[model samples]
Target: MAKPKSGAKKTTPAGKAGAKPAAKKDNTARLDLIKNASKRVAKATTKLVKAVPEAAKVAKAAVKKAALPEKAPEEKAPKAAAAKAPEEKAPKAAAAKAPAAKKAAAPPAKTATAAAKAPAAKAAGGKASGKAGGAASAPVVPAADRPRPRATKLPPPGEPLTKREMEQLLTAGEGRGVTGEGSLKGRLVLVNDMPNLVVVGRDKRELTFLLQGPDQEVLPAYVDHKVSVSGLIRKTTNHGGVVDVRKYSAKKPEAEVVEVAPAETEPRLRYLSPGEVSMVTAAGMGAGIKGFASIRGNLEMTGEEFVLVVSNGGTRQQVSFLIEGKAASKGLRKHVGHTLQLQGVVDKTSGWGGRISAETVEPRPSEARAVSRDEMELVHIEGEVPTSVDVKLNHGLTVRLPEQPGFTWAIEPTVAKRVGLREANFEPGPNGGPATREFFFTPRNPGTFEVEFFLAKALTPGQVDRSFKINVTVKP
Candidate 1:
């Protein structure tokens, strides 16, 4: 400390000992450039700690490449969950050799939420072993997206068997057998060269089958509804039978409006005349009636013949008789619905349309006459029709009928407006055995009117095979 004083005090102790060896020789190159910039920030934090676990193994190999379409149906798993195949190929060979620039630093919403939890943990935990952040991975199901097996064929061209297959069309003898566990109730057809699923029964019989398990999406929404199925029956082909469907129950009926009172616009029958009831059992069973007449109505009996319906206003007639005695057939069923007063005879020579032949049936006091005479013009009769007739004014009412070997009688010009036609013929018989027609009505205006007839096979009255009514009453 005393050597400086002589050099001009060596300028203050020789500038503090030559400024400590040149500021420690320039802070030794700024602490060796901050120790080589802290060794290049410790080699960029050790390459971001080795690229954040190689970007989480390239985001678990982009969620095992979005579960390689469900691991190619993992050979349909289940061999005891595919018993240890090299520990499930060690995390799919480390996620298929990860390194695609670690999926640009991973985390795209955690690789789409681990790509939807590896197909619901391979469908509720089964083919497990998939662990890059495992939640029981196992998805990779792409053999063009699974689900194809039931095939044997027959539903293309107006396709119906449940839109060409979904499991109900097992073709091998393509149906017409298997049926005997019984339970069908009707309707549901699809026929047109069936493939399987018919039902039509209610005695129409037709059973076909195959709509099992979940009833193939529930019995095709009841095709033509009215179902009632009830499983197991297989007869394949003795004309038909196949019902494997199980437990069914549908319905949809609603439409009725019948009201047949004295209304006759067709459907008003009284057939079976076997040659006019053997000519009324040889003219004696009908007691061979003839001239005098006085009928009235309401006495029914039909089967062994006794007729007499006679209503009016809305018209109705029916009067077949032969009342003999023993007190007139003892309690003649307490006179059915009394209102009688017959005293007949009018068998007008045959087919018995007026069939009177009575001889006493008294219960009168209900007489309400009103048919102003006009006398005959064509007044004949024949082959059935007499429950209580009594026509007159504008006469000319011959009827005759008798042909029926397939059919022919027509008259529905909007319901023969109370009889007006006037002429028609065809007698030929004795040789052909069954021929006879005549119809010639007249009464255009009277109180109790009616006059239908239908026996179809074209003449256009349609559908009523053998019906004939004549509820006559035309009087004044």
Candidate 2:
């Protein structure tokens, strides 16, 4: 401010000192960045180019392999030997068709029961609209036609009824017509998706009911197939001190009979991982549901019972197969793992488990079928842990183990000599199946032990035998 000094003696002029040098430095930095960026781009381009050639080579090799024809049998001696065995001839087509014809002619009628009728709808005034009003109405069982002496009182409109009450109404002395009598009017949820419906009142208790008609019929229900039951609801206690119901009719009473075709005609199925629940959900939620077939995965037998895990095309699943049989046998251990075709009723069960009932089990295409850890894990844990395991082998063969930590079948044996220590040991299983051998070695002294077995000549590197690893410790 004193004189607004025009220039400093030791400083460069403002235009020449800072501006040009700063500009030069900026240009140099920009050039360096541009050079580095070009180098990176060029490196990436070179890698991509190299990868393309390698990928092309692989593709070409695959194409060439695909073009090659399958190798013919180097030795036709087996075919010639088979031709000599007249007994080895293929099964007759007529013999096969005969059994199939018999099966087709068989009628599955378990009993003589009339078709189911849908229950009546409730009017806005809190009264039952009654059973079907259109065609297919229940044959009129007039008051005079009913067993003599009609029911004392038609059940209430908004309350749940008991099993005894229902029985009383069903037996409500002949001539006591129950049509429009409102015998079933409440929420009826089946127990475990069971055919036996457990009527629930507004209070949410089990209401036992007598499903009386000319004959007894199995009612079909999916998990949570919620619908209003509007027939006579007789509330009373049974001998078991449980609320009983007498549902005269339902709005939808035709037990949904899902008929599946025989196993041979079964469809090819895509398997899914366990986490894929949406696939199964979509199947059940279909509006016009028909029967379902188990495709994709193997039908496994555990504890003597069979089950199928249905896999969708993706990594998820939509259903599972549940077979009705005696509780799994205690000695049960192993089963085949090839995909199987099964036929049964598709049902929705309580909780996470639901699906179809398999009446038939047919083998599908696969390399080998064996029980995997994933299959064993599906077993429902109850009671004490089992000491031994039994596995089902192909061709009606069965294997048994007397103790744990001994033979892991995969690598343990191949030839008869290797089936057991020095000799083959065999025992019959419960199901009239062949016996399997196991070798036991209880070390007499406590020490580090290394056990090794020769790899079977018949086993390939990719076969299951290569993956078996067994470790055990013994103390005396």
Candidate 3:
């Protein structure tokens, strides 16, 4: 009312114009307060954002410091643990290497003789087991399973020879040229359509005997009374091998010679004629006086006690006697060329050489037993005569080798006309030095044979010189 009087021109309610202005001012102040608060909040958010990185850096530094171990034991714990891990693995590794080390040392230790015992015993047992395995694995080769030849020329069954008779026959010769002589006394019998004389005794293979007389005489004697013949043991080169009577005496006590008629079933020894002998001059001898003797050139079968021929190299009448019941030998120098009279019984028909038994070998006043490896000085016991020899090669040649040799060789026939080997069959062990070889060979034909020896160049220079003396034994 007082304000309205002052103005007087316009009058308005107190709630209208003044109230509108107050409301506007209140709104403006409220807006200003809200704006100020928003500003403060924005400033606080900016400060917080700016401090976040510094806080994080401080936290990181604290974490790093906290992670570091302060004590020596604490710091060393991790390193110790790491070392222990390797140690744990190392034990297993060492355990594995232990066996390897033992294996490496085993070979040398086994050479100590004492350590070899167990292994050797195990090896022997293994060998025995292997033998058993081999026996089981081998295919049976029975008599029935054996291969039958298209033509088999086997001798017919004959009477058996006796042990006492064999002993007596084998023990008689002592002097030169079958001085020893022996005989078997027995009744004659017919076997497989063949006449044979036999004695009763048990010993050795081929106990059966054969007839030493003509078929007619042997047949009659076999059909009639008991017959006994006394003579030196003569090896006949027929029907594998057999002994024949070199000098025979037929009948009982007093002894009588029965005229025999030749027949088909007679033993070849019976009809064989006495071997011829000839004398020769100037001959050479082998290194030893009684070494192997042979003719200068190849000769056919003479069917005599010993063939006589002129010496090829030296000057001396050499006498060669085909001595029965003795092993043949090679490697001689002095006796190679010789010519002399042969004093030994021989079967001309069957090419046999004979020897008397030891009982029949009685030494004369001038003769004495010689026991020496070198007997070249013994004159009475040594003579020069042409001889026939069979060269023998070792059997077991084509076997796998355990180790390589310095030299190798092949065989060649230098002088032998009748060679007993095939090409690519065998290789000698070495050259010049001691050469040895076992060979398996297929014979060209079935017959009494001989072979010469030679060497071929199968090695290069720089290899040591090897010489091999092949000692061959011929089996009849």
Candidate 4:
């Protein structure tokens, strides 16, 4: 080991060289750090420059999205073309999108907010694209200009109706008739002077149908003739279900034929008395002979049947009759309370007790007198009277004769008897009014009669009214 003096400087090759190298290393490190920092700043600035363009693109997209609503005008142009033809719709839609693409390329503003709104702008653009496509693809037609479907008529006879067609016919409103095909085997009868075809249904039900044609000439020839008719069933206001005949054909006659000797006979119409009609009705014998009968009675309805109550010698008997026509039914109901004379053939069957096939029904002759108000006043009767007065048999008439306050009146009994007056009453004068007399008399028979009233004397003097006469016509 070498001994070293005190306060001597120590020098080592490695140390000296190492110290310089360390200093150089430190400087190189600092330079490398500065270079790295500069590179980072340049990279950051480049990135910022690149991001500015991207943000501008995003802003352009956002602006385009904001302006999407403004493209409504372009969208509407396709509507006109769509109305003309559907094929031109695609070209119109493509034209609408070109403007949006051009607008998106030019950015409105370069900002962070624009970048943030990029996603929303893209979404809005997608929606606008879809709306534009939809508007162009579909064309709307005005409802008023569209052609309507034609109505279908009913099928002809022998052609079965479909389910849908039958439903339509059933749902048709009242007064509308549905046509049907069926066999109508019946006898022809005159109702209200109009020909009608009476038919018995398959269910053993009787139905009367009105016959109408060019002149109703088709039905009369078919009397007692079996027929097959195609008609329209309708419900009337008064008459029950009636069918209007449209077409009819006669059926083949019976095949059975037997030779028999001809016997001479004549149908004699015998007049039926009330007692004979009553006995026949009670016996329930079917229509045996053609008879003539006239009965005055009131009409009453029981269920679907109409009954005529005839009063003969204080005895009331019911006679039922089936109304065959609408006019007859309506007239019967109209004149229900009035006295009607029915002339018809009396028929008795097991089903119906007693019925009359009435050929004619009319109101009975009225035996009553109608006196006008002016005529009543001409007889010297005072006060307001009815416009028209009806004097019937067993009905009395009351007359009020007016007189002055100081006048005395006298009625002759002999004149009253001649006038068919049963009794007469005189009422005293009221306060501050003229005297009044009331006469009541029941007419014995139908004739014209006159009564005399004499003014005997007047206490007031100078009033000389001698006598007056009143004429009254009685009726039975």
TM-scores, all models, native as reference? 0.20, 0.18, 0.14, 0.19
lDDT string, candidate 2, 1-476, tens digits: 25446674665677877564343345555445444433433443343334333433433443444433221242122223322222221122113334443243222111000000000011111111111221124345546643433223434444334554445443423213222234343334544333334555434444445333221233343323443334433334331111222333445446878998766864544333333333443433332232443434444332334445443211112234445533222222444344555554444452223555555555667643232223321112111223233222111112223211211122232222222222112233457453333333323334333333222211111122322223323323
Q: Report model 3's TM-score to 2 decimal places.
A: 0.14
For model 2, the local distance difference test gives: 0.33
What would the per-residue lDDT of candidate 3 be over residues 94-124, giving only the tens digit for each residue?
Answer: 3544354434433333332232233334433
Candidate 2 accuracy as TM-score: 0.18
The Cα local distance difference test for each model comes to: 0.47, 0.33, 0.32, 0.47
Task: Using TM-score as the measure, name the better of candidate 2 and candidate 3.
Answer: 2
Candidate 3 local accuracy as lDDT? 0.32
Of the pair 2 and 3, which is ahead by lDDT?
A: 2
Q: Find the candidate with the highest TM-score and give its number.
A: 1
Residue ranges of candidate 4 with Cα displaced over 4 Å: 1-270, 273-290, 311-319, 323-327, 350-353, 365-476
lDDT of 1 by residue, 1-476 (tens): 55555547334565476564533335454445444433433443343334334334434554565453243332333222322322343234335433432242233323323433443344334323333434445555556745434323322223123322311123333334332445546566555423245554334445455444446455666776677766554545543455555467878755667966885574322432445433442322343334455556555432233445342111111123434433346455556545677664445233223455566778866444243225556566686674447777777677777756534465665445456555444343553366566666677677786666666532122345767676777777
TM-score of structure candidate 4? 0.19
What TM-score should be assigned to candidate 1? 0.20
lDDT of 4: 0.47
